[model samples]
Target: MNIIEDLRARDLINQMTDDEGLENHLNESRVTLYCGFDPTADSLHIGHLLPILMLKRFQEAGHRPIALVGGGTGLIGDPSGRNEERQLNEENVVQEWVKNIEDQLSRFIDFTDDQKGAKVVNNYDWLSKMSIIDLLRDVGKHFSVNYMLAKDSVESRIENGISYTEFTYMLLQSLDFLRLNQEEDVSLQIGGSDQWGNITAGLELIRRTSQEGEEVKAYGLTVPLITKADGSKFGKTAGGAIWLDEKKTSPYEFYQFWVNADDRDVVKFLKSFTFLPLEEIDELAKEVEERPEQRVAQRRLAEEMTKMVHGEEALNQAQRITHALFNGDIKELTKEEVEVGFKDVPTFELEESEKGLIDLLVEANISSSKRQAREDISNGAIYINDERQQDLKYFIDENDRIDDAFTIIRRGKKKYFLIKHV
Candidate 1:
């Protein structure tokens, strides 16, 4: 199947400017398309995953994909999906974020000088050089006040009162499209559902600026905004957004995010996220229907995502940490693995080289008091490194430490506490 067909199968296509025309354009030649990412934060999160993957999909299908980092428009945030004006960041901070996001985008898109190799461009290059007169006379003239006001992005924020800076964000984005179309021969722009207005505005600018009788091939497409089966926001948890950077969210935590996908959402997530064949996904969908308790689909989803975002070794490490935790074999994990596996668990730092088991338990508050500590030990409820230690006189020492750094103390069946050897 064609790339568009595959996207349709995954329900990735939320809105397309011209369905038939875009498909014909894709089939006719090696189409160059782009998706813009405004660096609002230090790292791109899971919320940005779909569009990045969309670019990769086009690249694999022998099309050039340009990953545009909005170093310029980022200064004046796009008010597309926001309810209020975004606080502008300092130029230096935005530049740092742009570099970080650029490095992250490089990991997904192949930049080697191949036939369909991808390119990363920063709009700041040209936008910064253009004077205000040039912007108003050349670009801004194409967009009328009524046309801009009719946009959902501007209209939505009309009552809240958008600033002139933000109100003109659409014009800036349109200028990006026109510039890329002229310089790089870009014919398509893609983004999330919220960006439909900006994408089409760019198309309008391209149409207005083209020579009379010129047939503009520029088109816009957007992917659906992901939703959860439970109606909670996607890409968020109690901890916060699931970041693409491993330092922000460890591979173990990232893996667990997909592994914990709801049964109702797992199949849809598999379709949207994974490059797994539809036939294979269909089989996984059947497993979701027949033996969901096994969680076969969820595990596969986690595997695909973890491997894609993090490398194979990171995926293995996450899986190893997960396995060690699930099998109650904490002793098998390394100090780093233990850190990632039990990162959210209660922790206590030991100042001394050794401490009596009862005192340690009470000191760490794993047990309410000394009496409860002894009672828990005597009742065979206390375990050190997954080994039941009923000895009331037992002392936690270097031997109990994993890599001489961490000691996993299980108070009961599942409540675990990490004792750190300082």
Candidate 2:
């Protein structure tokens, strides 16, 4: 299938300008397309996954993909889809964030000199050098105040107030497109659905800024904003944003994120995020309907996506830990496994002298009070290393240790704790 047809089959094309013409451009030869990512956080979250996947799709389909880091535009945040003005970050902070994001992005796309390989660009190079007078005369003149105010970005914040810096965001973004179009001959800009206004603004800037009657046509495409079927935000846990960085979010946590995807969103997510053929996805959808209890589709989705982002070793480790935890077999777990597997689970340390089973349970915050700890122990509700510990007077010692350094404490059937030797 062609690039546009593949995108259409996967339902990745949310909105686009002139689909027929864009397809024509794609079929003719190497069409250069660009997508911009703001350094709003140290690492890109699942929200950024759609566009990155789309760019990968473009590259696989023999098109050049330019991943633009918004070092300049991040200084003045994009108001699109935001409820409030962004807390402006310092220059150094944004720069560091940009570097981190670039590193993370490299794992997803090929950056080598081969044909159709992706290349990273920073807008700060061009945007930072322009003078205020030159910006006003060259680019700002094409965009009128009336046109800018009519945009949903500016209109939504009218009552509360939008700053001039934010008001000028579109012009800056449009200038990025103009620069790319001129320097790299890029003709298409892709982004999330929220960026439709900004993408179109860039397309218009390209049309107006070029020579009269120039055929340098530009196009805009956006993918749908990912949302949970239950009306909650995607890629968020109680702990906070699921960062791409392994340190911030462990591979197991990232795998669980996809594993927990709602039934309604599974197929759509597979389409948008995975490179599995359309027929295969359709087959998986059928399997989901036939036997969701097996969760074959969900497992495959989690495996493929986690492998893509985190790598093969991480995926294997995540799967191994997942199976071991599900079976209540803690013996197979190693120290590194324990750290990443139970990273989010509440933890508390106990001194070797305070290693009594009841005291450890109470101190680990497993039970609210010592009375409850004793009650639970008496009722055979507590366990050590997955073995029932009914004796209230049982004291944790070196014998109960998993590797001569740690004890796995379980309160009731679900809550788990780790007691480590100092």
Task: Report lDDT (CA) for all predictions.
Answer: 0.94, 0.87
How high a TM-score does candidate 2 get?
A: 0.96
For model 2, the stretches where C-alpha displacement exceeds 4 angstroms are 114-117, 368-371
lDDT of 1 by residue, 308-335 (tens): 9998999999999999888877888999
Clash list (residue pairs), candidate 2: none
Per-candidate TM equals 0.97, 0.96
Consecutive 10-residue window with the lowest summed lDDT within model 1: 110-119
lDDT of 2 by residue, 218-239 (tens): 9999998787899988888888
| Candidate 1 segments whose C-alpha is farther than 4 A from its true place | 114-116
Task: For candidate 2, give the lDDT of residue 270.
Answer: 90
